[model samples]
Target: MAATLDWKLVVDTHDAPALADFWAAALGYEVEDNSALIDRLMTAGQLPEAAVAEHNGTRIFRGFAAVRHPDDPYDEETGIGRGRRILFQDVPEPKTAKNRLHLDVHAGPDAREATVARLESLGATRVEEVNKGPAGHWWVMRDPEGNEFCVA
Candidate 1:
């Protein structure tokens, strides 16, 4: 038998919190809140105040944020998701090329347009449309920071 390992998708972004919020809303996920852990670290004099910041009234790590499936199990003490998560980490460089890998969101047959529209309202830009005959169609879209994802 093979050993099982857990994993998460991590994206580099100029603004971790913003990207985390955008993805959380887009995927119906919840933003992971690490305030309790940060507070504990600070109280123990192990973390500096400059290492955290207030985002939307929540204190989060300065260069990282994450979102997880709302129903996924998570650690109560640290708010770290144990399953189905995406972590956004701050990068000094800007995104200048197409993503090598991208996410595909399925919205069934009738909800594609509405789903795309909703995503647009949340800062996604339509890049183009893809049609594969019998394979069906999907919209190629870019997130606020230019990462591409598809809605089908």
Candidate 2:
């Protein structure tokens, strides 16, 4: 039997390492370390020596990496992580349409505009805005990879 289902959201990125860093700051998450896995794979000859890369003193997988909130439960030594995580995976093609699942940021309404501006400065762009009568207003924005996420 399974204890629970763990969910991690992954976004396609061109630079998984840099994006992991950016999201670490933006979301107060810690980047996961994959060195042990890499080492084991290398020892088994499953991964080529050149397939692993390092950035900012962290061992990186060739096309994917993840970050989690620092306080989230993580293995003390290995730092193979869990909780409120986002993984960045490299994909050759650009994002061409809407995201099947998107994040809705729920900061207070008064903070929306400033938050939008801040995210814009962080490489996210406001793509659409919608308002409906009394309790409706949101800005649909695209991240650097063109994935849609909303701020409401």
Candidate 3:
């Protein structure tokens, strides 16, 4: 029998909040709140004050953030998504090379240009465009933190 698992994509960045905001805008996803949980931890003295930060009037994890699909189910109390999610974790070093594995955003055949423009406005830089002839075409882009992903 095959095993089933729930998963999320994790990305390392120098600034987790900024990258989380950028990706949330790019994918039309919602930023996971986690404020309620943070508040509980803080009140119980289980979490230090230095381990949290206020973002747009909400308390969030200091070194981590996440974005989730808009329609996904999530926990109301904890603000954690129960479906598709991307977690951004803080790391000291900057991205140094091309990503071996990258995400491909599908915008259908006609919406590619508009999608690329929107992504560019959201802090993604176009690295190059690839035309595979009969196969298809896609634009390679780097996110704000230099992680690569494709828009097709």
TM-score of each model, in listed order: 0.95, 0.80, 0.94
- Candidate 2 residues lying further than 4 Å off, grouped into runs, are 1-5, 36-46
Name the candidate, 2 or 3, with the larger lDDT value. 3
Task: Give the Å shift of residue 106 in candidate 1.
Answer: 0.4
Residue 124 accuracy (lDDT) in model 3: 95
The lDDT values for all models are: 0.93, 0.79, 0.92
Q: After best superposition, candidate 3 residue 27: deviation in angstroms?
A: 0.9
Weakest ten-residue segment in model 2 by summed lDDT:
1-10
- Report the lDDT tens digits of candidate 3 across residue range 69-105: 9877889999998888999999888788889889999
Which pairs clash (backbone N, Cα, C closer than 3 Å) in model 2? 29-68, 30-68
Task: Give residue 73's error in model 2 in angstroms.
Answer: 0.3
Report how far off residue 46 is in candidate 2 (Å): 5.6
Alpha-carbon shift of residue 49 in model 1 (angstroms): 1.0
- Residue 55's lDDT within candidate 1 is 95
lDDT of 1 by residue, 1-152 (tens): 54324469999999999999999999999999999999999999999999999899999999899999887789999999888899999999989888999999999779999999999999999999999979989999999999999999
Displacement of residue 36 (Cα, Å) in model 1 is 0.4
Please estimate how well model 1 matches the true structure, expressed as its whole-model Cα lDDT. Answer: 0.93
Q: Predictions ranked by lDDT, top down?
A: 1, 3, 2
